[model samples]
Target: MIKGIKGVKDILPEETPRWRLIEETARRWAVLYGFHEIRVPIFEVTALFARSIGASTDIVEKEMYTFQDRDGTSITLRPEGTAGTVRAYIEHNRAADPLPQKYFYTGPMFRHERPQAGRLRQFHQFGVESFGVADPRADVEVIALLWRMLSDLKLPSMTLEINNLGYAADREAYRPQLVAFLKQREETLCGNCRRRIDANPLRVLDCKVPQCRAATEAAPRLADCLSEQARAHFGSVLGELEAIGIPYSLNHRLVRGLDYYCLTTFEVTSTSLGAQNAVGAGGRYDALVETLGGPVTPAVGFAVGVERMAMMLPLAASSSESASVYVAGFGDRGSAAGFSALEELRLAGIRAVTDFRSGSLKSHLRQADRLRSQFALIIGDDEVVKGSAILRDMETKVQQEVFLTSLSSQVSSLLRIS
Candidate 1:
C-alpha cells in the first residue's frame, strides 16, 4: 500500500467539527472587520517567495518546497500566505481602489520541516491582511481581530508578545552596534547564529538555543535604536490597543524569524502545546510590496494554525442523534420502493437513510437500531398492495400503519420542522 508523504497530515472525519468551528469563527470575524475572502493557487513562480520572503531567511533558504516544471520554470508550494495576498493585490492593480483592501484566506501551506506537535509539512493557516493602510491604527486593529478570534475559540489564557523591529533607516543605524556585540560572543553563539551574524543579525536574537540566549542577552535592542518617527508609530499602536482594552506584554527579544517583518511584530502563545506553544504571529511589512517590484505598500497580517487550535479544545463524545428515519426492504421490488420512500422523507426535511440491496427484515431492523434511528419504515409487497406502510418507533417498539399519501407530512411533523 502507498503511504502519505512524511510531515503532511490528513484531517479525519472525527476532528471535522472543530475545524469547521474555527473556520466559521474566522470568517465571521473577518467579515466583521471589513475583509473579503481571496483565494489563491497552491503553487506560484518560485521567485515570488524568494524575493518577498527574503532569500537569506530560513523560509527561503531551507523550508520552501520548490520544483522545476516541464516548462523549465521553477514553482513552489506557498510556505506562507502574506506574499501571495500581496502579489494578488499588485497583479490586479488593487491600489487603484479608493480605500485599502482587506483580504482573508484559509488554506493549506507547505513547509519542509520536521513534523512535531501542531507543526506539519502541509499544515493549514487562516490569515487576514490589509493592504494600502499605513496608519498605526491599522496595526492595532489587526492585532485586536486576532485576539478576538482566539477568544472566540475558547483557547485558554493566550499571551500576546509584542515587539518593534524598527524601520529600514533605524536598522541601518543599529546594525553595526548589534554586529559588534555578536562578534564579541562569537565563541559562545550557536553555529546558525554565528553564520547569521553577518547576513542577518536580527534573527540571532530569535534563536532558541540556550547558549545563544545567554550570550546575546546584552545585544542591542531594536527599540533602543528606533527612529523618532518609528518610536511614535510603535507608541501609537500600543496606545490604540490599550484604548480598545486589548491586553499585551512587551517581549524585547520577540524578533520573528522571518526577514520581512519591520516594526509592530507580535505573537499569541498558548501553554497547551508545550515546546510548540506559539499559535499565531505577524507584524508590519511596509516595504514588502515595493521589494517585489510593485509600488511601496504598507501591510500587516497574522495567521492562526488550525491543528493547534484543535489540540487545545476539549475532547468531544460521538453522538448518534442525527438519524430520524430508516427504510428497509426484504426483496428487490421492495428495495426500490424503500429508496423512493427515503427520498420523500429527505425532501420533507427529515434525516433519513435506506439499504440499497434487499436483506432479511430482522437484519435490516438491527441496522436501523444501530444507527439509533427514531423511526423505521418496513416496505414490502403487502404494504404496497394495502396502499399503506408500517412506521415503528425503534425506541418504543410501537408499530402503526398510515396511508402513504400522508406519510411525508407525518414525518415532517414528527421531526418538528413543520
Candidate 2:
C-alpha cells in the first residue's frame, strides 16, 4: 500500500466538523468586520515571496518549496498569505477602487519543515489583510478582529503580546548598535542568529533558541529606537485596545518573523499550545505594496493556524451529535417498503441512513444499533402487507406503527422531528 507524505495530514471524516467549525467561526467574525474574501493561486513566482517575506526570514531561506517551472521561471508554494494577497492587491490596482479594502482568506500554506503537534508541512491558515489604511485605528481594527476571532473560539489562557517595530529607518539607525551588541557574544549565539546579524539583525531578538535568547537578553530594545511618529502610532493602538476593554501586554522583543512588518506587531499566544504557543500573529506592513512593484499602500493583517486553533478548542464541543434515522427492512416486500420510507423521512427533514442489508428483524435492529440512529423505521412482511411500518426509537427501544400513505407527516409528528 502507498503511504501518505510525511509532515502532511489527511483531515478525515471524523475531523472535518472540527475544521468546519473553526473555518466558519473565522469567516463569520471576518465578515462582521466588513472584510470580503479573496483567493490567490497556491503557487506564484518565487521572487514575490523573496521580496515580500524577506530574504533572511526562515520562511524564505529554508521553509519555502521552490522549483523551476516548465518555462524556467522559478515558482514556490506560498508559505504565507499576506505576500500573495499584497501581490494580488497591486496586480489588480485595488488602490484605484477603495481607500482601505479589507479581505479575508482561508486556505492551505506549504512549508517544508519538521511536523509537530500543531505544525505541519502543509498547514492551513485563516488570514485577514487591510490595505490603504495608515491610521492607528486600522492597526486596532485588525488586532481586534484577531483577538475577537480567537476569543470567539473560547480558547484558554491566551494573552495578547504587542510590540512596535517602528519604521524602516528606525531599524536602519539601530542595526549597528544591535549588531555591535550581538557580536560581543558572537560565539555564544545560535548559528542562525550569528548569520542574521549582517543580513536581518533584528531577528536575533525573536530567536527561540535557548543560547541565542540568553545572549540577547540585555540587547537594546527596539521600542527605544522608535521614531517620534512611530511611538505615537503605537500609543494610539494601545489606547484604542484599552478603551475597547481588550487587554494586552507590551513585549519589547517580539519582532515578528517577517521583513515587511513595521509599526504595530502583535501575537495572540495560548499556553495550552506548549513551547510553540503562538495561535496567531501579524503586524502593520506600510511599505509592502511599494516593495512589490505597486503604488505605495499601507496594510496590516494577521494569520491564524487552523491546526493550533483546533488544538485549543475542545473536540467534544466542536461537533454536535447527529440525529439520524435508519431504515431496517426485512424480506423482499419489506425492503421495498423500507426504501420508500427512507426517502420520505429525509424529505421530511430527518437525517436518514440504510445498509441495504436484508435479514431477520433481530439482525436489522443490530444494524440500527451500530449506526446509533435516533429512530429506525422497521418494515417486515407483515407490516408491508398492512401498508404500515414500525417506528422504533433506538434509544428507548419503544416501537409504534404508522401508516405508509402519510408516512412522512405521521413520522414528522410522531418523532416531532420536523
Best by TM-score: 2
The sequence of per-residue lDDT tens digits that candidate 1 reaches over residues 1-418 is 9999999888777777777888999999989999999999889999999998888888899999999999999999999998898899899989888776899999999999988878899999999998888899999989999999899878997999999888988999999999999999899998988998998998888889999999988887878888988899999999999999999999988988777888899999998787889899999999998888788888899998888887898657223345788888656666667778888888987889866543878888988887778888987778877777788888788887866778888766665731
Report the Cα lDDT for candidate 1: 0.86
Q: Estimate each model's TM-score.
A: 0.94, 0.95
Model 1: residues >4 Å from true position, as ranges?
A: 315-321, 331-333, 395-399
Error of 2 at 101 (Å): 0.7
Q: Candidate 1: TM-score?
A: 0.94
lDDT of 1 at 97: 86
- lDDT per residue for candidate 2 within 138-202, as digits (tens), equals 98999999999888888999999999999999988888899999988999988878888888888
At residue 40, candidate 1 shows an lDDT of 91
